[model samples]
Target chain A: EAAVTQSPRNKVTVTGGNVTLSCRQTNSHNYMYWYRQDTGHGLRLIHYSYGAGNLQIGDVPDGYKATRTTQEDFFLLLELASPSQTSLYFCASSDWGVFYEQYFGPGTRLTVL
Target chain B: GQQVQQSPASLVLQEGENAELQCNFSSTATRLQWFYQHPGGRLVSLFYNPSGTKHTGRLTSTTVTNERRGSLHISSSQTTDSGTYFCAIGSAQGTGSKLSFGKGAKLTVSP
Candidate 1:
C-alpha cells in the first residue's frame, strides 16, 4: 500500500499567522493532492501536483498556495491564516495512470484563532 | 462544476445486517470511488468502480455510468464497520487527479 504522511498532525495559529503543512509519500506516485474537509463540505480539493515543480489549481484555491518541491513531497501554505481556512487537511497520492484510487495521509487539523 | 450526492445521510444498523449506500452524480464521470473513514481518521479507498461491478471482501460496489449513479453493499455489518462512507467522481476530460466528493453517508452499526 502507498504510504502518505503529513507533519504537524495538529496546528494552532492566530489570524494573519503563516502556517505550512508538509506532506510526503513513499509510494513515488506522480499525482499528489491537498484537500480540506469541513462539516458539510465533505472534501474539497485545494491544489494538486502531477510531478515535481508541477502545480494545478483545484476547486477551492483561494487563500491557499501549494508547492511540489519533489515527486515525493508536497506542501500547502497558508500565508495569512483565518478561521474559515481552519479545517482538517489531507494529503493524498496516486499513480499516474491509476488516478481513481488515492492513498491518504492521517490528516492535519488546523485551528485558527 | 461537478457534484456528487450520497443518499441516507445517516443510517443505523444491527450487527450481521446488510447495509446499502447510494451515490448520484450531476455530470458524467469517468471514475468513481468509494472510501471509508473512521471517526478522526484518514480516508481509505474501499472500491474504485467507475462502471460495472466490483467486489472485495464483504463489500460490493456497482456503478452505472450511463445512469450516473453507484451503489455500495455491505453484508454482515459489524460494529467496526461504523464510519462515514464517501463517494467521489472524476471527470473524463481533466487531468484525472481532481475528484468531486459527496457529503458522505454516516453509518453506525450496533451489536
Candidate 2:
C-alpha cells in the first residue's frame, strides 16, 4: 500500500477566510489529485497534477487553486472560503494517472461558517 | 464528460447475508475501480478491474468493459463492511486519463 498523508485533519473558518489543505505521498507517484465530497455530489475532482510544477483542471475546479511544488507534495488552497465550500476534501496519488489504482489520504473535513 | 450511475443508492443487509452492487457508465471506460470509505473518513481501494472478475477475501468485482458496466459482490457480509462503496470509471484523454465517480452505494450491514 502506498503511503499518503494529509495534514490538518479538520478545519473551521469563517466566511472569506483562507485555508490550505496539504497532502504528501511518499510513494513517488507521478499524479496527484484533489477532490471534494458532498452530500449529493459524491466526489468531484477539483484539480490534479502530473508532476512538479504541472497542473490540470478537473471536472470541478472553480473556487479552488492547487499547486504541486514537488512530486511528493500537493496543496489545495481555498481563498475566501464560502459556506458552500464546506465538505470533506481528499487527496490521492497514482503511479499511472487515473487509469490505475489510486491511494488516498485520510481526508480533511473543512467547515466554512 | 462521462456519467456513472450506481443502483439502489443504499442497501441494508444482515450479518452473513450476501450483497450486490451495480455500476453503469454512459460512455466506454478503459478501466474501472471500486473504493470503500470507512465511517472514519478513510478511503481504501478495493479492486482495480478493467474487465473480467477479481476477488479478494469475501469481496468480488466483475466488470464488462464492452457494456460499460461493473458489479461488486460481497459474500458473508460483516458489520465492518458497513460503509460507502464508490465505483469509478476511467476514460482516456490525450496523453493521460480521467476518472469519473458515481454517487456511491451506501451499505449498512447490521448485526
Candidate 3:
C-alpha cells in the first residue's frame, strides 16, 4: 500500500502570519498535489509538482505556493495567511500512469484568524 | 472550469440494503476514480476504473467514457460503509495527474 503523510494535522495562525504545511510520501510517486477543501465546495487544487524543484499552478493557486524538495517531501507555503485561507488542506501523490486513483494524505486543517 | 456534478448530496441506507451514487461530467474523460472518506478524516482508495465496469468486494464502479458518466454501487451496506463517497475525473490536462472532484455523497448506513 502507498502512504502519503501530512504534518501538523491541525494549526491555528493569525492573519498575516506565514504558515507551512508539509507532506511526505513513501510511495516514491512522481506527482504531488496540494488542495484545499471548503464547505459546500469540492476540493480545489492549489498547486502540483511533477518532480523535485518543479511546481505548477492549479485552478486555485492564488494565496498559496508549494515546493517539492524531493520525491518524498512536498510542502505548501502560505506567505501571509488570511481568514479566507482557512480550510482543510489535503496532499496527494500518485504515479504518472495511474493518475485517476491518487493516494491522499490524512489532510491538514488550518485556521486563519 | 471543468465540472463534475454528483447526484444526491446525501443518502441514508439500512444495513443489508443497497445504494447507488451517480456522477456526470460536463465533458469526456479517460480516467475515473472513486474514493471513500471515513468520518475520522482519512481517505481510502476505492476504485480506479477509467472505463467500463469493475467490482471489489461489495462495491461496483462503472464508468462509461462515451456517456461521460460514472456510477458506484454498494451492496449489502454495513455500518462501516457510512461516509462520504467522492467521484473524481481526470481530463486530458497534464497527461493525467490532476483530477476534478465531485461534491461527494454523504452516506449513513444504520443497522
All candidates' TM-scores? 0.95, 0.97, 0.95
- Candidate 1 lDDT over B1-111, as tens digits, reads 888989999999999999999999998887899999988767889988879999999999999999999999999999999999999997743554588899999999999
| lDDT of the candidates, in the order given | 0.91, 0.92, 0.89
lDDT value, residue B72 of candidate 1: 97
Between candidates 1 and 2, which one is better according to lDDT?
Answer: 2
Worst window of 10 by summed lDDT in candidate 1 chain B: B90-99
Pick out the ten consecutive residues of candidate 2 chain B with the lowest summed lDDT. B90-99
What is the TM-score ranking, best to worst? Answer: 2, 1, 3
Kindly report the root-mean-square deviation of model 2 from the true structure over all alpha carbons.
1.0
List clashing residue pairs in candidate 1.
Answer: none
lDDT of 1 by residue, A1-113 (tens): 88999999999999999999999999879999999999988999999989999999988999999999999999999999999998999999988734457788999999999
Note the DockQ of each predicted structure: 0.61, 0.74, 0.63
User: Tens digit of lDDT per residue, candidate 3, span A4-46?
Assistant: 9999999999999999999999987898999898877778889
- Fnat by candidate, in order: 0.56, 0.72, 0.63
True contacts kept of 1: 0.56
DockQ of 2: 0.74
User: Which docking class does model 2 fall in?
Assistant: medium
Candidate 1 Cα deviation (angstroms), residue B28: 1.9
Write the residue-wise lDDT of candidate 2 on B26-82 in tens digits: 998888999998988788999999999999999999999888899999999999999
Task: Compute the interface RMSD for candidate 3.
Answer: 2.1
